[model samples]
Structure formats: structure tokens, C-alpha cells
Target: MAYPTLRDWLFSVKTFAAAMLALYIGLAFELPRPYWAMATVYIVSNPFVGATRSKALYRALGTALGAAAAVLLVPPFVESPYLFSVIVALWTGTLLYLAVSDRTARSYVFMLAAYTMPIIALPSVMNPAGVFDLAISRTEEITLGIVCASIVGSSLFPSRLAPTIIERTDAWFRDAAFYATETLSGRIAGSAISGARQRLASTINGLELLLSQLAYDHTRPDVLARAHELRGRMQLLLPIMSSLADPLIALYNSGRQSWPEGLEALLADVIKWFNEPLPAVSEGYHPDASADALRERIAAMRPPAAALASWDGALLSNALWRMKQVVDVWQDCRSLRIIITREEGSWRPHFRHWRLGGTQRFYDRGIMLFATVSAGLAVVLACSLWISSGWNDGASAVTLAAVACCFFAALDEPAPMVFRFFLATGISVLVAGVYLFAVLPHVHDFPMLVILFAAPFILVGTLIPRPQFNMATVLVAVNTATFISIQDAYDANFLTFMNANLAGLAGLLYAYLWTRVTRPFGAELAASRLLRSSWADVALTASTLPIEDPRNLAARMLDRLMQLIPRLAATDDHRHPSIESFRDLRIGFNALDLRRLTGKLGGEAPAAIAHVLDGVRTYYESCVNRRKREPVPESLMRSIDAAVARVISQGLANAAAPTATSPTSARQLRDALHALIGLRLSLFPATLTSPTPPEPETAA
Candidate 1:
């Protein structure tokens, strides 16, 4: 006995009111295409006031830019249709590329920039002089729709993104806790961990979107401030968690060095601490002191600087430091969970501070470049075919083709979706005809018009939130508005309506054909490419200058890893995926670790480290190529030995000289060497572990 929720009813009514008002304004102004205003209402109305406002603003701006582009570009090349089409195609391609690359709501601007040119300019190709008026009408109608949607959505039982943000934030940490538990256990299978990683990445991306949605919400200053703080804290969780894994993996692989004393006890205590209930934000979390005490005890056992050259000492010391980091992150997570949950409202004083850096994502330039070409080709082919046919309704085909290409630009498999769009267009045409002929013709007044449209608008608006139903509903709403064309004086012409509808369907068909012919890569292949590319980047990171900003590169690589994990987990053999995925990630972390430590080295150490890095790249390149595994060559092993010796000796010399500006960080240097060694062994199991430590003179 479930009933219609308040949210659904209010959202439906707001959508209906916005559409009716926009239609009234459009009819009053006598815009050339009043249907556009009506259609824009459904397109922009969202459940949240902030989301609605944000989307409407961006949509309005994008529409204006796109309209202006069509006006300026179409008239100049009108004399040459092919030249004009090509120019328009180039503009569409460039904008589409930008739209696909951006991951935020701002991308709506680029999407509009890509398709609006075709919608406006292509229809006026036969009469270039009319382009200006067409652009103005398009802009004015869209603006009217945007204004109506924003006003109605904000005023009547308006929703706030703060609540949605909080909901998502809660879900994010729940998944994060599950992921953290697995990672800290140190005995979990790769497949399980990889899947958890995928969820974490998704949560991070979700949180990011919620953070952006904050700009639109104005409900609670306390909640807003807490959310900002939570997002910054969330950023540190991934890197810190990633850092902890290296030590666990190193300990697992080291058969010669005995486990560091009290290590297992510490791990058990941390796991127990993590298992405790997360405190509510209002509860003011006080971290358990046992975890901190364990970490301090571990730190007090650090080996003397001279003892670091011992392989066992290096392994133990590094493990302890990573354990300390694990504790810090554990404490941080518990504290943040409370902060994010606490609703301080206006009572929370906002502190002005430099926010902690968040994870950065990389956009693959090469893929974007290729996408630009494909988009341009899609437009050129569709437009050229329409022009050559000289069909009276060519505008519909040209416009739909560009719309399909621009709208579905984000999908890896665009052809199937294009076909769906084609089917949806056909269905929209059918319902649109029923409404236009049977109901709209009888409507004599605006009040009657509202009644006629009420059911369709409310039902469709309710379904808009559903992922599967959204596309079809939107198409129906749009086509109904366009086809009915309810004006003061009715013009009932069947052939004109049929021609327009068929042209719309034909446009989708053109897009479908173009995509099928191109044979774009599907999700699996794209994901595979992403994994291979990440490996290449890892190898480059290992070999090249450590000066480059690695966070963005790492974030992108992790992003790809996140996407790849589910696909790999779905395959038959989960063990191999676990091994390979975690293996590569472990290697990447080690490379980053070494790169950071190398900055501390002096004398011949820099040159020696460079030699080791070159060799390290060669080992990973083999993994990237999926070639037969090889031993770390004797020469490369010798180079690593020399580099380690140089760093250890330089640190001892620095300690001996009291006047030195800086003493070499012996523990960190040893940790770096240990990470490189661990990476070497992980890459090549066939090679026997070096039996003894390199002597001081031989290393020199």
C-alpha cells in the first residue's frame, strides 16, 4: 500500500507549472518556435532547487553561445554549401570533444555549443538572410523556458542539494569503510580488493559531483561548511590507504626478514578500532588511545642510522612508518565521519584556511583528438547526404543527426544507443500525432491547453528520474511539444506533421549508420586500452624526471584502474586479475616512493638512482607488453646496490657533520631502496632473491 511521495507530487506539479508558464510566455511573445520554450521546461526542471537553477543557468548560457555561433558562421559560407557544412562540422567536433572530456555539469555548455550550431544554421542553409532571426528566436524561447523552470522549481516545495549531498556522503563512507577493512586485512584476494577499489573510485567521483552541487544549495550554512571539510578529508583517504598497502605487500614478499616485533599486534588493534561503530558528527569523536600508543611504541623502536643499510632493518623500519600512517588515516577517517554527519547549521563558525589538495584527474589528449575527428566526420557525412538529396524537410535530418552525435558522445558503444534514439523518435512521433490531432485541436484557451497537457507532463516528469525511462520520456515530451504546436489559430495539416516526424527519425538513422560504419570500440576494449595505457604511464613515471606533478597522473591511472577492475572481476579467472591489478598498482606506488626519496640524495647518488630507474622501467615495460618475464639483469641489480650504498653513506656523512644545512633522512632513503627491491621481486619471481647485502666498498 505504497502511496505517491510528496517529492514526486511537488516535482510533477512544478514541472507542469513551468511548462505551462513557458508556453504562455512563448505564445504571448509570438516566437517563431514556441514549442522550444515548452520543451525546454521539461528538459531543465530538476527535483532540487539548486540543481534546477544550476542546470537552467548553464543551459541558457550554452544556448546563447551556440545560437550566436550559428548566426556568425552560417552567413559567411552560405554561398558554398559544402564549405559551410564543413565549417559547422569542425565547430561541432571541437565543442563535442570538450563536452566529453569534462566530467562536471559545466559540460552542458560545451554540449550545447556542439549541437546548437546545427539546429539553427542547418535549417537556414537555403536562406542565409534568415539566420539572424532564427538565432534570436531560439535564444529568446530557451531563455523564457529557463526562467519559468527556475522560478517554479525554487518557489514551490523546493528541494535542496544539501540533503542529497549528505545522503551520498553517507553512502560513500559506508562503501569506504568496507573497502578500508579489506585493504587493511592484508590477506584478502586481489579480485575482492579490486572490486572494492572500483566502488571507492565511484564514491569519490560521486562525492565530487555532490561538492559541485553545493554551489546551487542555500539551505544550511552549517551543513555546507561541514560538507566542504569532509570533501577535503576524503581526498587524503585514498593516498594514505594506498601507501599502507606497499608495506603489507613488502612484508608478505620478504621470506628472509622476520616480521617486525609487535607488528601483528598493532595490525589486530587497528582492525579492531576500524570495526568499531562510526560516531555521529554531533557525538564529537574521540579517537581510541590504544592505536596511537601502539604507533608510538613502534616508532620508538626505529633502528640507528648506521643499521639502516641492513636489509632486515630497512624492511622493519619501512613497515613501521607505513603502520604509523595507517593509524593516522584511521584516526582521520573516524574524526571526519563525525564532522560530515554533524549539522552545526549557522552555529558553526567557518574558518578560512588553505584547503587540503584533492585528487586530480587526467584527460587523455590522444583519445580526445581522435574523438574530434570522428565527430567531425559524423557531421560531414550526415549533412552532405541531406544536402545532396535536397529534401524539403532536410532540416530535421541534419539537426537530429548532430543531436544524436553530440548527446551520445560519452558512450563507448554509441551505435546501439543511436538505434534506441531512432526507435524513441519513431514512438515520440506516434504519441505526438495523437495529441496534436485528437486533443490539441479541440483546445480553445490556455486553461484548456493546460488540462490537455497536464497528464503527459506530470507522468513524464515523474518518470524523468528513472535512468531507463528518462531518455524515452524526454523524447516523447519534446516531440509532443514540437508536433502539437498549440497556437491561437490551429493549423491541422497531416502531411506537414508526417514529413517533420519522419525527418527526425531519418536524422537518427543517419547517426546510427555513421556510428555502425565507424565501428567504435565497446566498453571492454576501451577498458583494456585504458589498462595498457596506465602501465605505459607507470613505466614512464619510473624512468623519467620525478619533478613532474605525479598526483594527476596517478589519479587518472587510478581512475582507469577503477573502471578496469569490474571488467576484470567479471572474467572467469579472478585470481589473475587480482594479481595483475594489484601488482601494477603496487609497482606504481613504489615508483612514486622512490621518486620522492631521490630528491634527498646527493653526490653520485642522483646519477646512480637514475641508472636504477632506467632498469626499473625496462622491467615494467616487459609487463606492459605481456612478454615472457625476465630476471632483473645482473648489471641492473648491481646499479641498485650502488645507489643504495651511496644514499646510506651520504646520510651517515651528513649526520657526522654538525654544520650541515640538512641531515640526510636515513629512514626514508632506506624505505625507498626497500620499495624498489620489493618492486623488482614482484615483477620477476624467476630471479633468485639476492642472498646477502652488498658490501660498502663494492656498493661505492
Candidate 2:
């Protein structure tokens, strides 16, 4: 093998060495094994699973407290298995409940308290007099394991999460820029606009997760500050983007179809605007005449072709102006070169704020809790079954397997991860067994043992940052060291280590196979259901007739489409792939179209309602391909705007028609107008397609 490849191979298994050395020290010196398991579990699980530093602290604290509590309780009820089981179950339930009820860092404490009780307390019943000694020994082992794991993880091959966050954020900004430009241009419909809006929201969600990690870890202040600033700028952009939708749509719906020669030049100017330094506001440069003249020409444009052309011109002008402003602000901020504040008091971090009703639709909380509990139970059950079978080493073997499984399972939601855990453990056992039996007897010196132990950890730790090989090497080293330390070749310890390691491997395989069989269908089903529901919503809104109450309906449709678009993007099934893709495309188109109509109605209840209904019919026909793609070739978007303008003009004329009409007739007309406005607002809450039905009725 090449020298670099061989060096890399050795470096990747460094953590495994640390784990092995810690376990060997504890077991070889007759220290307790459970403490090592506790420490190893915490360190390995935290970094492997992407937990924040605060969470790791909570977990450590909880484990320590639970272990202490278990030491106190286990002895008093040792003779009665039934009482012990009940106490364990009740204690676990209480901790789990507390974890569920709380939303802050304290929740991790509750989770730890519940599970720690079992690991520490149950083992003491085997020998009451030796309980304290065992507990102390276990604590020592755990501390050593934690220290080793942390050193290996942080120093050897640390994975810095900040770069990933930056990359994702950049992608979000690019997508947002495209979305804003498209909305201003009025080249897409309301549904497409809504889809873009939804994508923006999703990107925000991802950013929040990254920030949470940084906060929990107490990362550099400058990084957090930059992230916060970016978030603020993005928030400001949303409202401005929303405001431009109507004007662009109106211009598109008017008669002008082609961009004017000067307007085309302006569009090119805006596209290259992001890189340019912001223009300084000079004195007496009133340059207002040119803009006024352009507006007049836009107003004089006729139907169809005129609407499209005028909209193109307006969008280009407005976007160019806004782009200049944004670029200026960006340059100013960059030039200040201000370091992000690291002090806690510098800014009130809003990362943890959960708005009212935000949690209603996020059902993953329950599933996460359930999975944790299930893992604990699976371990306990394995131990019980093995002990009942009267196999002398069965109980210990099961316990070892259970602990190993628990460590890995805690980090990942899906079952496949457990396989990695088992593989690591099994390989460690085989390698350690071979080393202890075949190589150890030949090297009696303490220096040789130290070299043997240190070499693996340093090598594996160094390579742990690599994505593919790090975990496997770390796991192998950990399991091997742990097994060799606990087991003595001349005694029963050797056989016990082998059996326990094998059991752990078996448990992992079972979990992996079971999950694959059960949850394989979830993603596909979610995609199909969301698509059907989105289509149904479109049809229902279109059917509402008299076309005067669409604002509320349009809002509702937009909400539903937001939830569905992501799911469609994630699915990989090739069955009816085009159908799903087209459905998503149509939904995107419709959302943008609806938003344009909303803008034209300008809060005129009856007119806005009528325009939405018309838009919905067109949206639906486009979905089914019933209306040819070119049906609105003359830019009917402009006609819809004109119709809206006419309705508003007529309503004003009627309101000024004076007391020529009866009081009852006037009252009825006013009530009808009021009802129309209410109906338009009501459309905003329509049910959106979701991977799962949301518990809340409204979209965030």
C-alpha cells in the first residue's frame, strides 16, 4: 500500500484506540466497566449525532445524577424483582414526561435522569456489598472514556460545522435573488410566486437549525453576528418582494407584449447591478423627468401587448433602483469590518423563540421521544431474556450489546445507523481478541502496552474527520479496547467479552432489518397525497363562483402549495414522475398568478373576489392542459388588471351617486360590498397540501 494511504488508514482508527485504552485501564486495574460505557456513550454520541454543546452538558449532568440516584435506590429493593421493575418504569416515565413538557435545555436533563437510573441501579443487585466500589469504578471508567472521546473528536479530526452553514446561506441568497427578479418581471403566475415564497421559508428554517448549533456550542461571536445580520436583511426583503407582485402583474396584463428598446437596456443594467458599488446621492441631480415620461408612456399602452411591454419596463426600472440600494447597504456593511459580538449581552438572541402555534404542526417531537424510550426498553428486554435462559454469561453479554446499541441509536432517528454501531463493535472485539491472545503474551513490558494503546487512538483520532471511514475505525477501537480491558484470557472474562460483543452485533442487525421493512413507503405516499390535495384545493377555489372572494382562497392555496413543493422535490420514485413534476410546476405557476390578482384588486372586496375567481379558472385549466399554454397569448393578465381598475372606478362612481337611491337599497349594496371583502380575506386560509395533515388551520 502507498505510504499516504497507510498513514490515513491508521489515523482513521485513533478514537477506537482511545476508547480501547480507557476500557483497558478500567478493567485491567479492576475498575468498574459501566462508568467507561457511560462516558464513551456521551462523547461518541454527541459529536456523531450533531448535538450542540449545551445538549452534551445537559446529557452529562443528567447521566451523573441518574447514576447517583440509582446507587441509592437499587439496594433497598434488591430482593423483589417486581418492585424493582415498577420503580424503574415509573422513574423512566416521569423523566420522559418532563423531557416532553419542556422546550429548553432542561429537556435533555430529564431524558438523562430517566435512562441513567436503569444503567447504574440494576447492576448493584448482583452484589449489594460491592455496590459503592462498583459505582465509583464505573464513574472513573466513564470519565476516562469521555475525556478520551472528546480529545480524539476535537483535536484529532474535528468537523467544523460553520462552513456548511455558510454554503447553505449563500445558496439561499441566490435563490431569493432569482425569485425577486422573476416576481418583478411578471413572467410567472401567482402559484409559482408562492412556491418561491415557500422555498424562501424553507431556507430560513435551515438557517435557524445552523444558528441553533452555533449558539449551543458557544461558537465565535463574529460568526453568529454575521448570521443574525443576514437573517434580518432577508426578513426585510420579503415584504418588499410581496409589494412588487401586483404592479408587475398589472403591467403584464395590460396590452404591451414586448419590452421597449430602452427598457431592454435597463433590464440588462439591473441584472449586472449586484456587483456594482452603490451610487452616491448627489445634490440637484433631480433626474425625475425621465422616470415620469416612462410612466406616462406605460399608462398610454393598450391591451394585451401593451400590458406585457409596460410591465417589463416598470419591473426593470424598479428592480434596478432597489438593486442599487441593496448593493450600497451591502458594501457599507462590508467596509465597516465590524467583528460579530461574542458577548451574550450584545444582542438578545432570537434563535430560540417559538412563535405561538408553531409547534402544532411539528409532530416529530412525539416520535423522537418514543424512539428514545423504545431503545431503552429494547436493551432491558434483551438483558431479561438472556438472564432468564440461565446462561452464566448471557446477562453481561446482553448488557454490553444493549449499551453499544443505545449509544448509536440515540444519535440517529432511522434504524440504519444502528448497523454502523454493531459493525464497529464487532470488528473491535475480533481485533482485540486476536491481539490479546496472540500478541500480548509476547510483549510483557508496560511500555509496550502503552505504545500499543496510544498508537491506535492517535492514528484513528487524526482521521476521524473524513466522512466515510471515521465512524467505523472509532467504533472498532472502542469495542476492542473495551473488550480486552474487561476480559482476562486465563479466566471467564475472555468468553464473556466475545459473547457480549456478538450480541451487540446481532441487535443492530435486527433493528436495521426491521426499520427497512416498515418505513420504506412513507416518502412516496407523502408526495402523492400532497399532490392530490393541492389539485383539489385549486378546483374548489375555482368553483366558488361570482369570483369576488378569492383573496382568502388564494392565500389558502398558497399555504398548501408551500408544504407540498418540498416533498415533491425530495421524492425519487420514477413511477408517474412526469405527472408529479408537472403538478408541482402548475401549482407554482398558479400561486404567482393568484398573488398578481390580489395586487390588482387593491383591497376592493368585490372586484378582487371576481378577479381571483377568473384567475383560478385559468389556473385550473392550465393544470389540466384544457387551456392551451398559449391561450393568453395576448397577455390576458393585463385585461384582468383593467377589469379590476374598472370595477374600482365603478364602485367609486356608485358611492358618489348620492341619495337618488332608496336607503334600504343603499344599505344592501354596502353590506354586499363588505361581505365581498370578508370573503376575499377568508380565501387566505384555504387548506394547503402537506406531507401530513397539519394540526393548525393557519400557515405560518
Error of 2 at 226 (Å): 4.8
lDDT of 2: 0.47
- lDDT to native, each model: 0.71, 0.47
TM-score of each: 0.85, 0.57
- Give the per-residue lDDT of model 1 (tens digit) for 1-700: 2344667777878888988899888888887778889899888877888878878888988898999999898878888888888998899999988887877778888898789888999988878899999999889999999999999888888888777776766666666676667766664445555566656656666676556667787746665655656665554465556556555655555562477666667667666776667765556446457666866777787766677667666556656665676666556555555655554322222221112232566565666666667778888877788788989898888889889888887776788988988887787788878878887777788898888788877877777756577787777777678767766577879999999878888888988988777746767666666666767776877877543566666656666665555455433242365346555666776676677677776577778777787887887687679843344577776776677677667666766774773434645565666665555444543332333464556777
Best by lDDT: 1
The collision pairs in model 1 are 281-338
Best by TM-score: 1
Clashes (backbone N, CA, C under 3 Å), per candidate, total 1, 56
lDDT of 1: 0.71
Query: lDDT by residue for model 2 over 82-173, one digit each (tens)?
Result: 56655665666556656654445556677667766766665556776666666666556666665665555556555555555655655655
Candidate 2: residue 506 lDDT (0-100): 65
Q: Give the range where candidate 2 is weakest over 10 consecutive residues by summed lDDT.
A: 687-696
